[model samples]
Target: MKRTFHHSLPAFITIIFALCAVILAGNAISLYNNLLSLRNTNSWIEHSWDVKDRLKNVNVLIMDAESSLRGYYLSGNKTYLGPWLTAQKKIEPEFKAMAELLKDNPVQSKNLVELKALFDKKIQLMKEGLAAFNDGGLEQIVMLAKTGEGRSTMDEIRLQVVVMESEENALLAARSGRFYQRYQIAVAVGMAINIMALLVLVLFYQLIARSFFKRLAAEGELKASNEHLEARVLARTEQLSILSRHLINVSEQEKAKLARELHDELGSNLTVLAMDISMVTEKLRPTEPELAERLQRASATIKTTIGLKRRIIENLRPSVLDTMGLAASLMEQASEFEKISSLQVNTDISDEFDKIDPSSAIALFRVAQEALTNIAKYAQATQVWISLRAADQGLRLLIADDGIGITAEALKKSKSHGVIGMRERMLLLGGNLTVTAAANGRGTVIDAYLPFNPAAQADASVAG
Candidate 1:
């Protein structure tokens, strides 16, 4: 069955988190913009109030100056002129402050300029009234005031204040409306995002729960399968071990039978031939001397043939391994190898080696024979050292040579049956075989170890 959230689950989860983050970021931006809008609205409301205050101050100062000028003209007292002078100085500054407050609005700023010009004309008219009253009498001042320039200027200033204040109020309303809308949008988006996030979290937890249960079920099945497989492997290994033992026993029995045939059947025939020739030689000696000499040579040749057959039988199945023991068989084999190969063969056999089981002794003897054979064929050594000892509750056989060392490739080659057979023999005896370069970077060393007792009889195991 296909898995529910198979390979793409992680990617799906990552995309969900990314969407949540984006929602949160968008909501945060909305809230920030709303906050800025509210701040701007508040600033514009404050500005409107400031512009009104400046306009009110300007009107009050103009009225005060007009009243002071009239009083000064009526009583002809310079003390009444002090308020007029003070109002003249203050009104211009008030107008300047109002212009600065409304500078962002071009229409309001332009209105302020017109208002300033009108104030200047009103101030000039008031000053002219005072100067006329001082230079002549109240008549010129009355004449100037009757022209209604002061009233016209006050009216124009009132109109400009109303216009600028109206513009400011409109701006405040618009900004407030935008702020409210932005706040509503932010709140709506935030609530929607929070609901989406809750749903995503629920789905994530569901996926995790499902995955956990699936893993738990899979683990149970895997453990059961492993136990079954292990049982099968153990059964197969036991069968192989039994089969190997049977084959080795059968091979050994055949070898012993062949050796017996060669020793008895072939050896008897050659002995009979030698006896007949010797008898003929004695009879021919009385008749023909040359014929008798030829018979003697034939008899000698038959003896040599019988000796060769005996040696071949002994090599096939050495009787010394059973009668004289493992140490004697190894030493005899080494001496024979030396004779055949004309290479020096050194032997060192510990007395404890003879105390091992007969089967173990036989396996070790065969391994030694195989090692010497390989050395004779491949080592090209001038001298070989063969040693047997008892150590670690087992027997160790070490055969070392001084010649060209064995290469890794040669050791791993499939055709190296001599080395493989030696190893199999040791394994059948519940032992191990290791071949390596000699200690002094010289030729090969074949080290074999067998338990003091052979495990079981197995002919194929011995040669596998």
Candidate 2:
């Protein structure tokens, strides 16, 4: 099955969130490592500068020691030897510290060893010059100075210190360059990650916007389709209502016409036949006794046929509904139904129905008649209650029977034309009918509500 946005949206969002989280976590870890790398590189640069400074300090101390020794040899001043001794005391420790600082670098450590050897040689030469000055006085010292051997050794010492200082400077420059490169790389990586995250966010936003608009458009189309369907349904319902009303009116008119024809035409013809039979019976009674008996029997049969015709006409449209009003008619029907169905029929019909419209009166009477018929056929009970009263600016008729109740399937079935006819009659009069299990839970109740407005009487008259 194809999935809708609603179905897939959560998974899509979850995947996006997970991706973003992973990317952010990776960036966080990368940035932390980069920060550590930058700090280490910076430390290396600082250490290289410190080593270079230390090497320069060692050279300055050696020069001071040489100057002090030369001064002592030339003037034989013990005060000059004091500086020389102090220099000798400080230089070894300084040289050792420089070596310790460079211990991590094998190349620098080797260079430091060479530099220390030169330092020792330079110091030994200074000591020998001092000893010669002490033993042979100023003359030996002058010869020593003149020979240029100590000067040459000092030049080599200076050259060695210069070489060491140059190496430290080179190391410092390399370390500085490395630190800068690491800083640049960290910045570049951070910027790239940020840009990618921003692009992802923008894409997510666009996707959300597109999804929202698509859903909105779909909803709009659905709403329009629903509205069109509702309009069509309403139109069909109205048309059916009108057609049903017209059919009902035509059927009632036809029944009235047929009842009038039977009562007027057939009834007159039967009356004349009865009078002729009575005249013939009088004529025959004086002559043939058997013929007179046959004529009397024939008259009785004609009378019975007239009675049956009257009943059929009454059933078609009761004249009592017009002459005696709704309440009296309902009471009469209740009595008739009680006699026919052998059920106890109780009635409470208010006189307010006397003012009810003629059309509404007919509909209510028919509904009651149908209810009684249904009860006679279906209700296996001994009691029935029929009531008609004024309620809610109209009339309510309730017919209840203590019998087996109507089932939902039976009530809803289309084959129950009698019930459908009752409902249609009530609907035509702007009323409603409901059949339900009695509130007492014993049987069924048929409740009919027909609204009556005195003002609408004029409209009913016009329509009639």
For candidate 2, list the clashing residue pairs, or say none: none
Runs in model 2 deviating more than 4 A are: 1-226, 457-464
Candidate 1 residue lDDT tens string, 1-464: 87665665588778888987887887688778877877887787888888877877887888888888776765467787787889877887787788678778898888888878878887887777777877878667667668887677778877876886687778778877877887787788888887887777677888768878999999999999999999999999988877876786677778889999877766886788788888889998989989999889878877888878778877778888767777888888888889989999888987545546656776787788887778878778999999998778688899999988799998899998888888877887688999999878999889998775443324423632
CA shift of 129, model 2, Å: 99
Residue 161 error, candidate 1, Å: 99
Model 2's TM-score against the true structure: 0.50
Q: lDDT of candidate 2 vs native?
A: 0.84
Please provide, for model 2 over 1-464, each residue's C-alpha lDDT reduced to its tens digit, 9 standing for 90 to 100. 99756555577678778878977997988778877877887787788778878888888888888888776764466887776788888988898888789888888888888888888887887888888878888778778778887778778877877777787778777877877787788778888888878767786787768878999999999999999999999999999989888887787788889999989977997889999999999999988989999989989988998998887887788878777788988888888778777899999888655656777888899999999999999889889999998889889999999998988899889898988889889988799999899887889999999998677666655654
